[model samples]
Target: MENQSKKVTLFTPVKLGKFELAHRIVLPPLTRMRTVNGFIPNDWMVEYYSQRATKGGFLVTEGTVINETGHGYYGAPGIYTDEQVAGWKKVTAAVHEKGGIIFNQLFHVGRQSHRSLQPNGAEPIGASAIPHEDLVFTQQGWVPAEPNRALETAEVKALVKDYHQAALRAMEAGFDGVELHGANGYLIDQFLQDGTNHRTDAYGGSMENRVRLMIEVLEAMVDVWGSDAVGIRLGPSGTFNSMSDSDPIALFGYAAERLNELDLAYLHLIEPRINGNIEIADGLEPVASMHLRGIFKNKMIAAGGFDQAKAEDILEKGYADMVAFGRHFIANPDLVFRFKNGIPLASYDRETFYGGNEKGYTDYAFYEAYADA
Candidate 1:
């Protein structure tokens, strides 16, 4: 009874734009490299997502690259092809049959790529021609990223069109909506941060310039799906993929204000501690999301190592409208039920997280099965 009472705070239905969620628990976009043939969402991907689609809950698909050149990792899915669209339709159908609302996260990994992953051995594109020193996993193996070339002004506009087209493809694939992957040091993040984007054009340098690409992309996406069906993920002060801003609070605060004016579906902000799956920096009195919550006047979702108790606390305090679970959901398909009933979650295997078969993907036992064992 105590657990049930505590669960009420997190389980209450909330309005997120046009969708009324059954609960505030969100399954965040996790990059599981299970797509077959490098770009198609296969049968395993269908089974994988359907298992985690709890009725009345929200689930965002793994990062689906908008363009072939945007792909950085092996086995990640893409949305630009007709075959990929057909493949995702199966997954979305399965989730919808279970009464789960799913969103496809559109992505582009700017400079976070190797020549092996790019088309025709082309260099990866970014806001500048800077080289990222991080290693990325490819078909060949983990290789160091090559120096990227800055996208020309014409190319930038074309990339925005790519995002717009991807959103339309997501709709055709039967997604409930689309979430732009604007966080985690990806393409949009690369342009937004000063450390990577060193250009003096309209898409770099000043905060407005740095944020232009994302805003323009968002506007393009909104045109396709309407503002009510679009959401954006952001990581303010996130240092993943060697990314950092000159002044994150100022840059992100201004961005949030602009986003608020757009009246998009929601703003998904990853907590500073969970930046790029690594704890890079600390010592900010108030966290990034906390500061942005005061500035952005829209439904906000906060994610980053949040447990049920902490999630409940934040919801009760009105810090965010929803809480997204990542690793917890990875190991526990019925995470909402486990949290509500106080059931022990199954432990996850770290080795089988990325590119694997069914071992760590769909084999995690539910609470009932675990109890029987």
Candidate 2:
């Protein structure tokens, strides 16, 4: 038993805030575009998440809309309604039945949204009037929407309340914790990005000001769920939603340092790269994350193009405490096992990667089901 316990490399116990994770592997938040209506969790979502739960590691739910105005997808889950909380409760309960922990990732797409997805006649609100050059999937097909009115100071305060309410809803839905989706050019990311945020109010004009709303949101969530049960994800140099910063290093380094001061559960960071996997180039060797990781003594999770060899090497060198698997987790529910046993990975179906049925979502076979005996 002692040898078995000591030999558990990937299954080691790690402290993520108040929860003790049985493994250091995490299932990153992935958007499947499977929601049926404004914002509601479906049975397929329950099956999809429960299937991906690792016996040891943690699982973060897909980016869930916090309000009707935040609804950017047709099939994304929401935390604004009573029924939505009940639906997610079923999901969390099922994962708990298998002895796994899960957190709800709160999200709001700002300029990356289309008019069809917006609530009522309200335009899509952003940190600035600079609209995204990307197309959002809508019932009317892909259409260009103008930049939205900048959120007034009162509106920003309301956003903080929305975050708090969402955290409470997450608890009601039986999540072990909640993660703020502060990445991928969402509302929070929009505010953080220099190109998106050109305001001169207290929410912009400086690095500290740009990060004010995020900090307020975090504080509100902490008030609802406590600091130990909260986590935040950030993409320092990502250009997802027409996002760009004059000093990416300064923006993210400051954000990480502040997160460290808060002593939250974990800080998830997406590596910087334009296309494909983040290469281990000498110039972009996670200098900012390392600096932030040094400042923040809590659990640090890194995502974006991590394979088995790279993941193992990072762990062995202690670059990050936990590694989040995105596409790998999508195709292989037993991703940790596959990595540990050196089994060949089943490639994910690009066709069913987004806005699809259950073909690529839940039909991926496990090792035992297709083992070469």
State which candidate has the highest TM-score: 1
Residue-level lDDT of model 2, residues 214-252, one tens digit each, is 999999889988889999998878876567899888888
TM-score, every prediction: 0.94, 0.92
The reply for model 2, stretches above 4 Å from the true place, is 1-9, 141-145, 274-288, 369-373
lDDT of each: 0.85, 0.79
**Candidate 2 whole-model C-alpha lDDT, 0 to 1:** 0.79
Clashes of each: 0, 1
- Residue pairs in clash, model 2: 35-75
Which pairs of residues collide in model 1? none
